[model samples]
Target: MSTSSVVTAPWRLLWRLGLRSSPLALAAPLVRTRPDPDLAPVALRAAGADVAAEPAALESAFPHATDRIVVLVPDTDEDESAWLRHLDQVGGTYASRLAALLDWTPVNVRVSPGEGTAVEVATTLQALVDGWPVPVRRIALIGHGRGGLVLRAACALRHQTPDAWHELVSDVVLLGTPHLAVPAGRTMVPLSRRVDEELAGIVTDDVVDVSAQPLPHARYALITPHTRLQQSRLGGLLGDVLWWRHRLPMRPRKARSLFPSATLHHVPTHEIGLVNHPDVHQAMLAWLA
Candidate 1:
């Protein structure tokens, strides 16, 4: 058979296998994993709600509320409108899968975009939480592509700021994040390596491998899975055609922080692909539950 013919079955087979093995396949009682005892009972503050001055007010309102909020902070302000649109589609797919599997409302929290790199994003999160009456319980910070890199850097930033680590973070999740460096058009290789390597030289913090740091006893981690989405439209259309195959990198990549520990969950590129991968996000939700 031709290479094109070969592509059809292998991906399908992998998808089937994933479905059969996951516990998420069976009905599982998923709930919020991290519950902050110190946080006073309070309601869920609306998005853009005032978490700046009285972040603790949230804790007081939904002390026992499931604080599994998703923070939507993009790393750069560059008008990747096209890319962001694709991400929104993927995010919606992820939300749907979560709803079908666990029936939970997916929370999307947003941090400012273009403010800075991963560290800057984390700094923003810190500032937002510093004044909180109670900190978030089961926090799941998720970003797409470059946003994921920013999220990784933000997790590392949390490690540096011990005070912020007290009750704000739980698990950091990335959707189709690139951890290595790639050329302008290549989709498989990460684009952040050059920057991370450069930063590693200036900062004694060893910021290059931002994924390796341990956060405040939280389960610091990453989510890398395969998807049809590529770095560019042409790449996406080709769909994992050699250079566009997205996966975790070998060197100078985002290291899952030991402070919180990390896990790598690979998904098939088609059928139940990363965006719709049953086990990947569902497993995290299960674990967090």
Candidate 2:
């Protein structure tokens, strides 16, 4: 069949499957994460990395509250070693957590897991600021992968606990994550679905009800590559050309909706090289500013 025919065929199927031509919205419905009891915590001792035992000490080290805040939220299931591995593979030039903190110097805090679902990390942050020296004015959050989703969940929970949010919470920023794909939109569709199935209570319609809140007091900056948009956009334009020649369905933009208050931005991997774009740290800082 002709290349044109191939492109048209899949789009038709997608349309039948409820795909809409209108630009995809950035906001996603409330989604939650389930703890993997089977995945034992890899001893941090083996990884040889220093992880803070106390959440408050971690918050105090960097000053995200006074001026511009950078909160580092890691993937839901990933332990410290996984974070280190990601940094190492990226040539260690930047610590994913540290790099984000440095972008906006006011203060940087790294949120950690605290005895519940990954969402607890956000709750933990709330607990830390019960009576902070300075009230959290503005926030700039940076979450990686599932951690990004956790950030959204954190914001959602604030509504349920207005007093807690008023006390210490501010705003959020997300790193490389796909917000709209809840269970089947894109990016780990099966994973999202599995999470929704097992934990239906939290991952309900309001998980990220962008329409209701419209514009939460936050700025969200997302970095995506067309090639690596799904995985990594390495190689070159020639490679992209070849990919389109053979790859099917015309890669759809897999993105999530940020509240109307957000200033949404994208960094294509072709120019910067896909997969893990190095400039995300800077991009986030500038967006927050």
CA lDDT scores, all candidates in order: 0.41, 0.40
TM-scores across all candidates?
Answer: 0.46, 0.48
Give lDDT tens digits, candidate 1, residues 1-289: 0112123343343243343455343211111123344432221224434343244655554344333444543323222122233344346445445445544334333333333445545555565455444444545665554556556555655345556632555656655555443223333333232222221111123324533444555564444433322232222232442332334566332323322345555454444334434455556567545
Top model number, TM-score: 2
Q: For model 2, how does the per-residue alpha-carbon lDDT over 159-251 read when each residue is reduced to its tens digit?
A: 345545423334455544544432233334343333222211122233444333322544455543232222112112113222212335675
User: What's each prediction's clash count?
Assistant: 27, 15
Kindly provide the TM-score of model 2 when superposed on the true structure, using C-alpha atoms.
0.48
Candidate 2 runs further than 4 Å off: 1-68, 80-119, 131-135, 159-171, 181-215, 228-264, 270-276
Worst 10 residues of 1 by lDDT: 195-204
